[model samples]
Target: MSTFEDLAELHIAAEKLLMVPAADEWLLRGSDRRLDEAKFRKVMVDLLSAVNRSVGITGFVELVRQVEATADPVTGKVSPAAGAVVLLALEQRIDDSVLEERISPIMVVLSRAALRSMNAERELIGLEPLAVLQKAVIPNEEILFREMFPELAVSVDGYMVTAVGSHAQAITPVLVNAANPASPMAIGPLQRQLRSQVADLTVKRATMIARTETARVYGETAKETQRTNGITRSRLATAGDPCPICMEEAARGFLSIDELKPIPLHPNCRCDWIPDVENWLPPMPEVVQA
Candidate 1:
């Protein structure tokens, strides 16, 4: 049976390869270019269906709302502006998934440790779904360790490593599913089911992209914690939250002023950095008051 460790490892690998560059290729083409509206709608519908299957009904509804809200009225299509908005939303969902992936490993490892230390099935009384969940999560860890520890370590790899290695191969299924051109399901419930699955997967795909970017940013080794010096950049910008580094209020500013940075912040940072040449300038140093 699979242990949480096995499942966690699988998740890590899955996270790494789940989103590919090609996943957003269609979205990118929607800008300025006159894309086939029929094709674009079809793509969105397929994407909705896939997300519904994996996540459920609520996810699909949310995705449809986002797509509708962001779609361009001018062309009856998704424009760069809409694409940008949806992409950020996609990024937020990914952030949640990343946290989920990191914590899941610990859960699996600890659960197995408990089971083995006790050595009795009855010791797991009232564990119910957790017991089953653990089994499903890490089916092969103990077996592999007993059967081949050193070899397994050599052959297999850490979660991040395996994830990076497998990401490209994993993209195909997502692409095929998201790009499916099938007619919408006839039944209402089935249609709902399809949308939920597609929405969930859409979010998952975003998370995968975030993970891959994170791995790329961190490289093979651990990254040192970066210290940022908050500097205000522009006064002619939006007044609410200023960019810490350059105090400007562009539409794509980070949530916290302290979080502001160049595009692709923290491997998975979906915050965009656009150049407002008219407003761009170095932040003035704070003067000490007497």
Candidate 2:
């Protein structure tokens, strides 16, 4: 079995190989070719399609098929035969929530990491630890360093894709700004700036995915630990001089287990709601107001 670090490294490697170089190549040489919003989006669709295909959701998709398959009420088993699948849907029931449980490749890796952290916290408090993901995919939004998004995008074909980290909104400006990007791209400021923006966008999206999983798991785990006579309050800890908003959030001091989540944590925000259990994780630099 692949460890969390292994999967994470694979994701990073895939991005570096598949997304960044191709995007930069296009930006440097192709952005000027009758550039327009629609065209740029098309380019994005192509790039993201390639990336998704490369990373693959093979394992996850297979799992989804098994979990979503209608189980026979009598035997409590499912057959792989096509006839059995048809009969299950027509005869047995299908779970609508099953589709939602399907996790992305990157998410599976990140969520596993979150479980590790959550267990670490539980171990500190002498409580039983969790081992499964019982939630939707979410990124660690509080991370300060990332190697990559605008937001989720749905193309005209009803397909949503992540273009490395570029978004529909950013495409317009990139369409305008990417003209005449420096050749021998490594030497040009605008080329670097454009590439940097994409990297920043990707980082935001990736962080959000990782943070969402980590925060949700941590918050829920914190609540669970509290049931075992653990700490009831949480402190909004920060690295240092956080932006105004985080400064304000920090002022709120201790919050209940229910109120412990500070998610949708602003970009550049390094604050995490630590269980006020003493000796929690160290504070991170607060996010500057966006």
Best by lDDT: 2
Task: Give the per-residue lDDT of model 1 (tens digit) for 245-282.
Answer: 33333444434333334333333333332222243333
Candidate 2 C-alpha lDDT tens digits along 180-212: 223222325644564565556555443222233
List TM-scores for all candidates, in order.
0.21, 0.38
Candidate 2 RMSD to the real structure: 20.8
Candidate 1 has a TM-score of 0.21
Q: What is candidate 1's CA lDDT for residue 200?
A: 53
TM-score of 2: 0.38
Deviation from native of the Cα of residue 98 in model 1, angstroms: 9.4
Give the top-scoring candidate (TM-score): 2
> Which whole-number lDDT from 0 to 100 does residue 181 have in model 1?
35
Worst 10 residues of 1 by lDDT: 219-228
Residue 281 C-alpha lDDT in model 2: 45
Q: Per-candidate RMSD vs. true structure?
A: 22.0, 20.8
Error of 1 at 145 (Å): 14
